[model samples]
Target chain A: MYDDRKYTEENMPKTGILLEVENTELKDINFGLVTAARDTGANEVLAFTTEELGTEAQNDLARYGVSQLIRLRTDSADITSSPDNCAAACVQAAREYGLEYCLGLATAFGRDIFARMAALLDVELAADVLQIDFKAKTAVKSHFSGKTMATVSLQETPGLLTVRPNAISPVEQPATLESSVFQADIQSQAKVAVKEIKTSDDRKMDLTEAPIIITGGRPIGKPENYAMLQECADVLGGAVGASRAAVDAGYAPHSMQVGQTGKTVSPNLYLACGVSGAVQHFAGMKTSKVIVGINKDKDAPIFEKCDYGIVGDMFEVVPALTKALQQEKQG
Target chain B: MQIYVCLKHVPDTAANITLKGQADYEAGAVKFVANPYDEYAVEEAVQLVEKDGSGEVVLVTLGPSEAVTTLRSSLAMGATRGLLVKTDEKFCDSKTTARALHAAILQDGSPDLIFTGKVAVDTEGSQTPYRLARLFDLPVANEVSALAINDGSAVAERELGAGNREVLEMKTPCVIGTTKGLNEPRYPKFPDIMKAKKKEIKELALADLDPALDPRPNLGKLEPVPERSGATMMEGSVEESVAQLIRTLKEGKML
Candidate 1:
């Protein structure tokens, strides 16, 4: 273990990306993935949490050419996430390393937790940044202000940014590196306790990170009929999305809803089934490379935003699309 | 019970916004109001305090003096008090606004619960409540549609995707970001509106809070949403339109 006292300011490398793992297993996964995504820049990639990085995650990180992994241990295993603790830790880390930027995954937990860190640091929290131009020293496209794209630069030290999950394609490279574990200064019990962990059984993937999304609106009519859209998503390896109108109308859950009021997504492919393509709904997913709209109303606003329009009953079209996917997969 | 509801004044949702030159559209010829979503937050706090039968609800805002309108609107909804932290235009962003709020909340002592809308229509940040929860070291439930305060804890149903729902039980001193389904925010009654005129609104300057936040996105330049072309009507029977649609879909390779 590197002594906190012995590690002086001059020797510490600049620019480290930190990730908190859900468990020791996830810690491994995060380090592995992060190391794989690392570049030739002279710096470090670290994962900090209650547990040490797993051997498998270390190996993965090595594959990606990461120089080393630093796992910071926490006192309690069941520490809850708080904006305060994260902010304090991040700010301390940034100030110590004289880092340029802090990067985080744009998960629901990250969005909630990192925004506070940005607030505490007195720097802007650039949410849902799709691409980071390291050479240009800029962040490209954050999710905010309704379906808009922006590139931001920070004159200040250690600007915080959250990366859209699928936006950065993870790559694998082989390397040889050592993994070191250290304890965090803040005790885990000092942080807020996560009261609960709830996972929806209906989805195989998280909506915010899904590469493909098939969404529906109130036009889908009944809640039970939503299964048809789910079938399409299942075949595409995507998650189901809903419009706020659909959620307010009792057709879907609020978590799945997307708009100015809900989650913003920029998947590779977005399919709107029975969604009228309201500006609010479009605002959430317009960044997608391809949009397909299936609506009975030929004049539905969604047709304008979509690359393809299916003027037909979503009920019939969705089943057929699912069947097509099944056939392609089978063949 | 002392309850505080955070409010923000925002551009009216109904305004026909146009893309003027580059940096933040020339925001002219548009109407503005207290953010519509925040109204629900204030209403929920007021209702919760009233349900308890003996409590005071306070409205707090970190913005310019113009934000007093938002505070007054909350008072008109039956809130007993108001606090406004006036600052430069920088407080317009959520991070700066949240820091200002943390300062105010710390000065005012602990609140049992903090409520905020899922996001403001102008800034459209759904992360502030979560961030605030972090700042206070409180548990948070984001985008909740329904909530029930129990003994020392609150049970809330959060909307998840694909018609899935998660009911999380959190302890007191927590933060919740409410969705539109929480309740129908009440319109200001006439009597309450008149009483709000006499309500004491404590206006604090930015200096008083010693704000500790950079109020910029710090990402890159802002760009406006592209304009939609005029609507096109398919002049044909439904079957003919479907044929044309299939043709369009195939041509676009969506088929």
Candidate 2:
């Protein structure tokens, strides 16, 4: 635990990053969040985890300037069973650690808990921010389908922020670490009855956190045809997405949608296959660093917006792209 | 089935937007509507009451006075009435938004369930429903694509992304943050629209909720995201294009 008594400097606020677990292992996205929570050398980073990290994981966090590992738990209830339960645990940690700022990824699970924590603490919350100014207690986030960037200034102590995944790359700065467990005390009454979590069969990576994304649009035509993009996405170490038209046509589910109404992504590389690149669709992936558009129509709007374009049928290009990427990997 | 569906008046998602200055988007001539996701929540609640044959589905919102116009659209879809917590400020913080709605709901007494859209379209906060759930001490589920209320509990199938669903069980008097695919919202008929305009819309001030409220978050500059330059088109066959794409990926260290 960071002793606030030892260093009461006004500039050095206590910062905490909520670590996430995927398939029972630490998620890579936490490294960027931890690096950000370090406040560019302004904060002593604290990593809050539900379960105790192994020596190797602790070492990994230490390299990113995480000085302390706090294993949040409750003696009265299980935190992992439900989001509210996890939130309650985090709330107790915020108070216990005297956290001035708390950060987490803006993924689905992160959104569930941080909002709960904000309400429980009666503090202002900022979700899915793209950039943070820790000293000012402010963040810059996109609004109105990523068309505008709004900087929100939070006033409350322990200001909560759920950062967009991959918004920042991980930076290494080694620090000695202290590991501790915080047992939260709370009432025994359970509000939510958390049941089974049905995991996906083919899609293992979360779209928002995926470094690369390959999306299918209207011309993909069939639900089964998404497999072609999936093959390409796999070779690229990425995830698959669908435009609003594809999802609306029932060729894909709303969960896979990437558009004005769907999930906004900021992947490093975005491949738009057969997507017409409507304003709504472009709004979602606008922040991507590099975009490649593949469409049969040479005049597709995506061609004008993307960094690279190929006028070809996705059916022919996607499979060939997948094979090429695979061979590049082997060679 | 006493249900409350929280609503937000927002600019249409597909509307062209221009900013006046910091945190201010020029609202002039922009077609405002009931938030798209909130429409799904209102739809679910109305369908539940319609199926039960006897119940009230109240619509609650916190925004400017003009928000009632948006609220009436939900009323046309068959809500019992509307509660408008008026705020002149266009970009009110979520904390203030949630607290006001919590207070306003208790005015009519606690209902059996509280429903909200998973996200507000303009802000895309995705926080109100969860914050309200915490303030009300209720179990909440966000991004819910499918929901069934039965025997004092809800069996909600929440979308967990990447084609997975979480089947959760929350007891009655809980909160549900509904999203797209939850249900198809009904368009109000001409007769229903006329009837909705006549429906009661009770108004309240922000101060009425809490006399000495906490300081709210403020939004700074609203600037447009810079546009991307035009693409570098690749010519020749599929194999050639694929090769060029691979070469670019390798050069950029993206492979």
Candidate 3:
């Protein structure tokens, strides 16, 4: 069955969603940007990727209502070699497509590219927004470490905005997919050259983008004990985190620390083990949809904020949960 | 070599931020300090000059008159001087801040390199370096965790999360927004502190900067984070609790 939209197809505003690829695989998060760009199911969505999208990536985005997928072409300059090159190329692609707004995830990669694009275009950027209101040309963003939320309007176009990853849920809206390539007329000076890229030893997803997070606090005795959380996180297809206490105590690196002093995360599920749920740690992850706390003390403050609580030793309880999740996964 | 570092005087992370009215926090109640992230930038710049053996590291900041104190604190960290762009507003969007900083940097002449924080702790608008770079037409990189300056070029390593590192080589006169793990900031010694108090800092009203535009309305509606209601705490044995947790997550389709 062919479905017709109430509005004229030619009259809809055009939006371009920049797809991110790592290790020759498209990040699953891009689909959410596609859903977000299809505001009210009328704005025509175009997906742009610096690299060629495989069949899997193409089908995934198309199911999210992406009407057009564009691969940027380059002559001598490699987009992967420089952020400036990618920014220049993407801005050119957006213009060639007549895109009213260019939207992307606010991941580390997206932030670098989109900010440059906004600067190159001389347009005010809405960076790291949590929600978008196309009708008013505005976005909602967190301020003061998530203590407050601010609404900002896009005052110009072709608009440049980056939505926080996972902030917008991906909706399956089927549309005929159109695939093509656009050669970017990049007038970019080669000021920056990429030397090398080294992946981490663990190579796990970043905490801010991980859908599920399993965090350990002071209780995990040694650095190696984080493996307990890691085992469970692996089963859940999530990332592991450490509280500020763990970092200060030299149990984990500052990169894995989750607190106002560390990374601010809003995951689908937050499993806190031995964490006290202090304001700083809480402030960093209070936006998580579901919080589950496990502590030895029945009255731990984490229980007050958690969606579920367990008064037990993490050494025993974590393994039990991991085993249970493993069986659940098998079943 | 001439190096410039951009600093911002922001509310301390520990300080409470209660709104005075709309878009304005209670200024008096919150203690202001050099943005902790910017401290990284200042430290990286000061270290660069120290390593070069012959160069000047200048600290540039935007804030009210009191912000000079923050600038001096950076100077005590071994910077040669300071440049303060005076503005009473507690907050300014990244665009205006970048424009003002661009103009202030030009006053000191074209810098060999510019450094700033990946994101200001207070406003957290992380686009200033890019915007400022555009105003200069130079290349820029943000969230760099490691860096080594070479002859008129720099090799910087930036964290892309998931433990991935992208090493880049940028030509001189570029902007860099540093993050944690770059370098440890040093606390100033007693004599250095006294000398920093006397360090030269040029002050200019943001208004005086080439007809700077008024602060844009970045905040249309500002309010506190919504209070979460009706938190649930599951009971019973460890296995039972885990089962209940799984059930709820599945029901919500968050699993």
In order of appearance, the predictions have TM-scores of: 0.79, 0.94, 0.95
Residue pairs that clash (backbone atoms under 3 angstroms), model 2: none
Q: What Cα-based lDDT does every candidate model obtain?
A: 0.66, 0.86, 0.84
Q: How many Å off is the CA of B166 in candidate 1?
A: 8.1
**DockQ pick, better of 1 and 3:** 3
RMSD of 2: 2.9
Across residues A194-303, which tens digit of lDDT does each residue of candidate 3 receive?
78888778678788788899999998978999998999999999999999898888999888988776887778889999998887788788778788888998888888
Error of model 1, residue A72, in angstroms? 2.9
| Native-referenced Cα lDDT, model 2 | 0.86
User: Could you give the candidate ranking by DockQ, starting with the highest?
Assistant: 2, 3, 1
Q: Which ranges in model 3 have alpha carbons more than 4 Å from their true place?
A: A1-7
> For each prediction, how big is the interface RMSD?
4.8, 1.6, 1.8
Q: Write the per-residue lDDT of candidate 3 for residues B1-255, one digit (tens) a residue.
A: 799999988877777778767677787787888888888898898888888888899888888999888888889999999999888876676778888899999977879999999987766678888998889988788888898888877888887777778898888788999887898899999999999989999999889875745666567777788755534776788888878878888998878
Q: Pick the candidate with the highest TM-score.
A: 3
Give the root-mean-square deviation of each candidate in angstroms: 5.9, 2.9, 2.3
> What order do candidates take by TM-score, descending?
3, 2, 1
Give the TM-score, chain B only, in order for the candidates. Answer: 0.91, 0.94, 0.93
lDDT of 2 by residue, B1-255 (tens): 889999999998778888885568778769899988898999999999999998899999998888988988889999989999888778888878888899899887768999998888788788888778878878888889989898888989876766778888988888998888888999899999999999999998878777755425488778888887889988889999899988987899777
Q: Which stretch of 10 consecutive residues in model 2 chain B shows the poorest summed lDDT?
A: B208-217
Error of 3 at A9 (Å): 0.9
